[model samples]
Target: MLLLSRPMAPSNVVLLLIGLHGTGKSTFAKAATGQDVKVNPTGGVDAYTKECNKYTVDFKQRRFIIIDTPGMADQNTIEENLDVLQQVADQLQNLDQERVNGVIYFHSIEGARLSGVDRDNIRILKKICGDEFFPRVAFVTTRWDRIRRSEWDPILVPRNRDLETERMKLLPNGPSIFRFLNDGESHKAVLDYFAGLEDGTAANRGDKKARRSGTG
Candidate 1:
């Protein structure tokens, strides 16, 4: 519920990562946190695991904690997965609302189409975090190199547009929408997105910030 006007010192914030499996959530968390990943207990207050890991990073005298939850689109019972997500939402609420800043939602270029599982997961996330959650959410499309421009462009155009529409419909006043392609070239863009979020700039605001701040 706390909207950061500027990126707080890393010491003052926590970031939560949510996406489907094989979406590069772990890789991103490791890259961002620079720590041994820790998984929350399955039955604890933060019982969101099976690849859902947590890590911490310190920058500019600030500490940033990131909780990486399992990819929702993985092979798991929808009920079980939703339960874990709910638990995560509860934990966030228990934490200082402001301490938990943004969420990175991963989407794979290989599987760009929103599947049934993805729709359900997003619904659950919206139910738990509220409609504005999407603005604070960034869509990270992984496996970009594997997608050919000839095939990817057309698929991506409508997909991206539909996704934005759905997200807005789900969370009419959400944070903001930002998109990124994951590949060798996209590495910097992905990093800049998070860094911008860390620095209090909404990474989804525009292409300019994304271009200037990304690590790729």
Candidate 2:
């Protein structure tokens, strides 16, 4: 239903996904869009590592233009991170009528603690999305299925809270944090979370390349 790929009209909502490489952004895109929507890495099926891909969601009375962007390396890829953010910004700027409705920044929960690299990545992301766009941004913790329920109960939940705390330090305006399983329900949850909110716009017009010294 979101097939009006040429240019978004006033009724459309442009959604964006941004995160570090291998954090399961593409995987979530494929699972969430289903077989009907075309997932990128356009060869045959489910190939990751493309620059950018677009998918659509047709709900009861709403349409969404989901932009899946390539993952950025938080370690030593300052230029690459800048390029990817620019790519997303360019696509968002193309919307003449609509504006960025929401953003999902993924964080894999495989690690036990947030490192300096993680801090750097979130800084760059904040820079890209601007300072006041937190209400529209959701920090989604991905790879939940990979963690054991027992471990989650004893370890993961606490760690997630700690991450949230640290996240607030960097992104004081960052919106709520949620866990994602990449399932049908999780997809709906993501949509519903944003659907409840008005289409909030993000002001990211300048060329604010995150500095290499965004080090933790």
- Top candidate by TM-score: 2
Q: What total of clashing residue pairs does each candidate reach?
A: 17, 0
lDDT of 2 by residue, 53-97 (tens): 678777535677787877666564666566667766665455432
State the displacement of the C-alpha of residue 119, model 1, in Å, after optimal TM-score superposition. 1.9
Residue 157 in candidate 2, Cα distance off native in Å: 1.2
After aligning candidate 1 to the native by TM-score, how far in Å is the CA of 207 from where it should be? Answer: 5.8
Which regions of candidate 2 fall more than 4 Å away from where they truly are? 1-10, 36-47, 90-99, 199-216
- Candidate 2, residue 178: the lDDT equals 64
Clashes of 1: 17
Which pairs clash in model 2?
Answer: none
Cα lDDT of model 1 by residue, 64-107, tens digit: 66777655646557797777676665655555343456666776
Reference-based TM-score of each model: 0.63, 0.74
Q: Positional deviation of 54 in candidate 2, in angstroms?
A: 0.3
